[model samples]
Target: MQEEEPRGWRPAVAALPAAAAALVYAWARWCFGGAAPPSPAVAVAGGAVLVLGASAAYALSVRGAGGLFGALFLALGLLSTVAATERTAARAETATCVVREVHAETEASFGEGGAEKTVYRLALDCPGGRPGELKDAPSPLSRGAEVRIAYDPRGRLSAVPAGAARPWKPALSALLLLALAAVLAAHRRRPQP
Candidate 1:
């Protein structure tokens, strides 16, 4: 028997998982980075819903391109949800910080054709009055600026300019989802059982 030719709609269907993952990630980030974050319970519940929906999508799509995308989406959704929950917990323990200094440096990359990049670093005086440097702080921050830092009992996890929303989580999540989609698409192109 001959194998069936691939259909155009398959690619579109496969993309749904990545799109859904992006939306979930964005929602989670927005919730956590907002002035009033949802309770941990709410975050966890949202995570659970995302995971379950992704899983169901995966199950329904098994044995096709959709299956590959669904699996990738499920993994990303799970990771983003967990990160969101952790951020929520950290937000509950946030502290105000003062930017003591803003240091910008241009550095050349060692590999990949030695590209140049500008790095922004901040010196922060956080709660408890201890001073430390914050590497890779968001740009446009200046000396003597006040910022908010989120931390657990052990250490800081994030620093954002005062009244600025944190964008790393959602951005990272979206990037990962896109990468996963690309990988799954490549995998799907390979001969299968």
Candidate 2:
């Protein structure tokens, strides 16, 4: 058996922040539903509510660095959730499209190292009943090249390169945060030597 957190109180107390974060996150999601993404101001307000609520719950029960870390996790998880939701909502379909035209333009990069880069602009034709355009596409694309694209079948979102948006990212981040919180709680609850 593990040497730490043999007591039940530690686990119980540690679960509070995660539970609170989830509850607040659910409430925010319910408030928004499946509608379009909330405005930046609204999203910020919702995030503040989550951070404040979860952090307060953690701080009230446990007095230590855990509260700050818990708040960090909560903020990161909520941000991820909002971003994934917005990305998924923005696109509803994927298709293999062919590049109709390619325009390669060279632009100077202002990075720490002075460099020049080529930007491939492409016009793509898809079998999804509409043509699409992609800008600053990665290299190796030419006329009649087939590239995967994601778009809104209802024409709500313009087509973008595949993998540009991921819907499952938030879930993964939340799971990781919960795991970290559990570990932190167990460590903090260890008996003093």
Candidate 3:
């Protein structure tokens, strides 16, 4: 017997949550500009909504939806956490870094507040002048120019020019993405009936 396609509006349903999330993010970034912090309860509520919506959408569709969602969420969450942490570290202090080299020009993309960010790469020399320091720094810099690089010691390649980013926002966003990916991955690997 031929296997039947699961056609209960799964793809469209699944897309709703993701699309909502994308819209919410875009609104936050464009209108708010990270000027205020969200209340914990509100943040939690929003997260719950996103999770449920996405899950419902996926469940209505095919068996593979879970795995794909998981990976997508995981990647995004991790990125948000890193960005938020970096913003906080750079808020107050200024650390001098020499522009070691500009990494080859690549089209860098990021979501800020919710809108997309277009960025270019610049390799910076750390305080102690460590060689091979061409790790990805988020901000654009000219080769040999000095800049104040603010970053979390625990998160490499998660820094920005001290004055450039809004602390906490990006991090929170990245965390959400990472968490979603993890949860989806977990669910996908489970034994199903």
Residues 148-171, candidate 1: write the lDDT tens digits: 765443333354443444446855
Which tens-of-lDDT digit does each residue in 40-89 have in candidate 3?
46654655565455544444332466756654564355335434543443
Q: Is candidate 2 or candidate 3 better by lDDT?
A: 2
The whole-model C-alpha lDDT of candidate 2 against the native structure comes to: 0.66
Q: Which ten residues in a row have the lowest lDDT in candidate 2?
A: 25-34
Give the lDDT ranking, best first.
Answer: 2, 1, 3
Provide the lowest-lDDT 10-residue window in model 3: 26-35
Q: How does each model score on TM-score?
A: 0.43, 0.52, 0.35
User: Model 2 over residues 1-193: C-alpha lDDT tens digits?
Assistant: 4445445777786676567557655645644443665665776687677767666666555556875676566556656655555555545568898989999999998988879999988888888556478776778586998999877665544466888765677768766776665566656643344
Compared with the true structure, all predictions reach lDDT values of 0.60, 0.66, 0.51
User: How large an RMSD does model 3 have?
Assistant: 12.5
Model 3: lDDT of residue 5: 35
Best by lDDT: 2
True-vs-predicted CA distance for residue 33, candidate 1, Å: 2.9
Looking at model 2, the pairs that clash are none
Evaluate model 3: give its TM-score: 0.35
Give stretches of model 3 more than 4 Å off: 1-54, 57-94, 104-119, 129-140, 167-193
Question: In candidate 2, residue 89 scores what lDDT?
Answer: 58
